[model samples]
Target: MLRFVSFTLAIVAMCNGQIAVERDPVCGTRNGFYGIEGNCDAYVECRDYRSREMQCPDGLHFDPAVAWPNYPCGYPMEVDCAGRGIAQPAQPSAECPHLYGFFPSPKATADECGYYRMCVDGVAVEMACPPGLAFNPSNARCDWPDTVSTCNAAAFLGFTCPPPPVNEIGELIEGPVNYKYEGNCFAFFSCEEGRARLLSCDAGYGFDPISGRCVDGDIIKC
Candidate 1:
């Protein structure tokens, strides 16, 4: 019986490793993307084995999860890019507010988050929160540092700037680096100058800084 149990465990381990490798999405792994014919708006880059930048039409966001054989950039957001196309500058960032005609979130409550995606000159960009502050999603608005008094941090854009650590003498610690946390895999710490600050991952994910992938902490070995 013990021998059988050990064999089962080994099989499970092998399956886990296989799934991890096969599920690991690569930037250019999708053949459907390459097959996308004609000229298109090249967007985010997948700097891996595919060895090239990815592209989609002007309004679509590059969702790596939806790679190859689908839309070049996966899915598309409902932005009025067709109505107001912002001329692409020489360089572009994926989180482009200007990609679509920016308008106030029609569904926003009176007490809205500070940096909600809004139309700036017909572009949708998330405006910055106050200097010493960050956006809090619980209230769907910006709040004081003390406003978030519990672990309900998943719904906010946390401020990453932290004061230097006083415990250690002023020895330069290499940083401005991001690290995954055992507590919450989706959230990560952006550490710089000895201070590590938390930044929330995208909705429905914990971050794995080692792989630079958003993952669920509940499953990762940490």
Candidate 2:
């Protein structure tokens, strides 16, 4: 698991840096994406390489070292650098499902069969599949999906695989209020008062009116 010492430290390290040089497939936007791209919520400004402008919405200097490259999937596997061999960040453990992660497309074709392909920055990398599973490009398996809701495949080594659309969310820096005590943190999530059946909470923390809670693996935030 990737652990940050403090939320303030995390903010100092992550927010308001340039978006990964690559483009975000969803909105076809580069330099940033959604609410995160260059928001400066963490009190920093990321310089847009194209515009060369330095602006931090939250009022902090951009830290080049902490910038998370913008990728299509929330947690993309590949790292993109302009003519640079940027090492990829490690995938987060399953205990915390919201961190960035990686996955493969499908097995390659017969000609390319036996080839294992991992999706990096939404692009497929051709390589030999690990022992056991034969490459089946048609299936497009991102890591092996452990569909059993109760199971934590990512937590166990060698038995699980990365979930597709490698999604990510910031870690829980604060505790919750208003909700009554629940057995665990994951269970506290339930639908808001008047909302439809959306998602349930894990235990200690219910959904954030702002960052939305995880409901059936779908992220529904305010």
Global fold similarity of model 2 (TM-score): 0.18
Candidate 1, poorest ten consecutive residues by summed lDDT: 78-87
Highest TM-score, which number?
1
Tell me the deviation in Å of residue 60 in model 2.
23
Model 1, range 1-222, lDDT digits (tens) per residue? 999998888899888874223322534452433322223344444333343555554444344345544454422342223333332342333444344433234333333333445443345555655532345445434454335343223333343444543437776555466666555656666666544455576766667766656677564554
- Residue 45's C-alpha lDDT in candidate 2? 23
Residues 1-222, candidate 2: write the lDDT tens digits.
Answer: 346556556676567762336422433233442233433222222234232233321112233344335322221112222233232333333322212222332444323233454443334455654422344333333232132232233332122211222225744323322222124333332222211111245533444444444343344322
User: How accurate locally, in lDDT, is each candidate?
Assistant: 0.46, 0.32
Give stretches of model 2 more than 4 Å off.
Answer: 1-116, 119-123, 132-222
